[model samples]
Target: MLVERLERFFQRREEARRRDYFYVTEVAKCPRQIFYAVKGFPRPPLDGQTARRMALGDDVHRRIVNALYSLGLAVAAEVPIPENGLFHGRADAIISLGGENFVVEIKSVHPYQFDQAVAGPRRDHYLQLQLYLHYFDLQRGILLMENKANQELKEFLVERDEKVIQETLDRFRNLHRLIFGEGRLPPIPDKSDWEYDQCRYCPFREFCLRDATEPPQDTLEERDTVPSEGAPEETPPEKEGSGKERPAPRDPPPEDGGMEEILLFDL
Candidate 1:
């Protein structure tokens, strides 16, 4: 079983490499995270919990597609978008409804998330569907979300927003300029607190934080000044006034087990 799991994992990774472009879902995430990804920075290995959640989400998607087919609806599964060097994605299914075709994007979320989404589409989820709508030239699409815990279903009808789509495309282009053109990393969207809950779960946390701590190396003089290992440490001169002791460093708090599952279509 372990061998089979490893094989499947590598197969997915290989398939991901073959498509060397960003997904709409990824571009919806923090640009700094995307920059690290595009630069080929190493990320932590996928945990089993995350893997299981992703598998479950895939199963839910398949089941939804099959159910649509059973109802005698025309369903196109895994519809690929036009290949753009900067972005690409596949709609889960396109179903013909009421004599009109509509894109279908499925998401499996926790009960609380489902409740929130029922009120309105989440930012990332809404952006992903809009990209699909723009790419397929469709005006309307459906967002189907299932509550993972209770298997409850909720659907929302989303119309294409040309302005939003254009904004998203512009953002992606700007991000490309920062990362690929200038060879500079984007600042973290939220950095006021290092112990921010989301930062703990971010895949690029180590790389992002490490870069934040180090000074930029824009010149040879600055680069050479960085001490090599075993070099004598320089001590600051003692002050002539009263001295104050520095506080000892404290360890970070334990992270919560909140893993963000990499969805199937994004993968």
Candidate 2:
């Protein structure tokens, strides 16, 4: 059984390499529909404590990019990670200069927790960029954010810490494993448990209070999946007069995974 599982895992990994099955599987396994009830809660803006001082919209992220350009960094917008099955993530900017490739995730932080929480969200982004490094074998990543009005960019050393990611992949190898993986959707905190100001901006708040309706489920579950690894070959149809054969469709290369960026200059 162990050998069979190992064989299946390798076969799936090879399929992911040849045809980007990771991307297809991740999209197909997206839990947005499954988590609708939990996601339907309202959270406040990043700077809800200060009236009229909150950072709203894309302006905050744009400013950080401008700062990088001024510093002579070549930025690539909306990089796709096909290996992990993630799509066009607007990487604040990607810099490839001075013989170094830098994938920067832009953010803004709340002033009070600026020092403490700055690295929390970007850790995932850095890990994601590291995955991109694996797919193309690049090195180095940077998490850039607006520190007050300055772009505070910190360089991170990408390491080969495949243990956690391997665990995640292994869990995905079987339906039963994935359904009961560690940290499967943590418990949601109660209203009093949350800060007073942080409850207004949650996308799901209305749903939590039964005050609004949710988007249709069919729309969220419409993603397609890759063909089964080691699928049996099908006999080709005979051509008309020439008796020629048609080619099978080829798969695209895989990309990386999801990213969570830091925003809010105050933090």
Report, for all candidates in order, the number of backbone clashes.
0, 29
Candidate 1 CA-lDDT value:
0.60
Per-model TM values vs. the true structure: 0.70, 0.43
Indicate which candidate wins on lDDT.
Answer: 1
Regions of model 2 farther than 4 Å from truth: 1-34, 37-57, 83-88, 117-136, 148-160, 168-267
lDDT of 1 at 67: 88
Query: Model 1 over residues 1-267: C-alpha lDDT tens digits?
Result: 697787556442200011134677674465666665545444445555555566787899899899878876636888888877677678989988767788888888767567655356666678889999999999888887888889887777788889989998998888777776777878645433222234434565655655642322332233223221111100101112222212312222221101122222321
User: What TM-score does prediction 1 earn?
Assistant: 0.70
Instruction: Put down candidate 2 lDDT per residue, 1-267, tens digits, no spaces.
Output: 686565444342111111222321222222321133222222222222222223231466666567657776655654554434322223456776666676655545433324444334333344455455544455545555444434354333344445645544453344323223331432232323222212222333333333233334442332233333221111112112322212322221111112333222222
- Clash pairs, candidate 1, are none
Residue 267, candidate 2: alpha-carbon lDDT: 22
